[model samples]
Target: MDDLPDDALGDVLRRLPPRWLAASRCVCKAWRRTIDERRLLRPDLLPLSFAGIFIQFDSHAFPEFFARPSPSSANTKLDFLP
Candidate 1:
């Protein structure tokens, strides 16, 4: 259900918390613009952005934190070694 079609991505962005949408912008340029416009129009999105930031910080601070690098960059770090 989370994987929305390209045509409906805007609506999905509207439903999601601003923070997730903001983070999602990194997914692509178009998505970032959509989320940025949505956030600009709706002040309520601020809280969601704040929550998003907190969640992001917590995840980054966790010992088990992990993320997939962009396909273009595969630099091996010690933490990712098997």
Candidate 2:
């Protein structure tokens, strides 16, 4: 993996979801540099704003979810359980 050129690495890394891409910063200096330099984590670039979010803190089997709103709706604030 280390042998790949920066462009190749950036291409692959860009495919990762934005959250994971940010987490990858802790993986290593080289990858951090590539992600940072490419500015791939820009929030404005996200395809959609999630109108609904759901997560099960104790259930690892269910994947967390972010749902897009109906065309007539807009994103709303979410309050999670403490």
- Looking at model 2, residue 6 earns an lDDT score of 98
Candidate 1 lDDT, tens digit per residue, 1-82? 3466545877877776656765777887777776676553365554442211222456547544345444677666788568
Pairs of residues at least 3 apart in sequence or in different chains that clash in candidate 1: none
Model 1 segments beyond 4 Å from truth?
1-7, 40-82
| Each model's backbone clash number | 0, 0
lDDT of 1: 0.61
Q: List, residue by residue over 1-82, the lDDT tens digit for candidate 2.
A: 8899999999999999887888887899999999989988896754674578887767657867868646766556575636
In model 1, the Cα lDDT at residue 26 comes to 85
Give me the candidate number with maximum TM-score.
Answer: 2
RMSD of each: 12.6, 13.1
> Quick one: RMSD of model 2?
13.1
- State the TM-score for model 2: 0.51
Residue 60 Cα positional deviation in candidate 2, in Å, after optimal superposition: 42
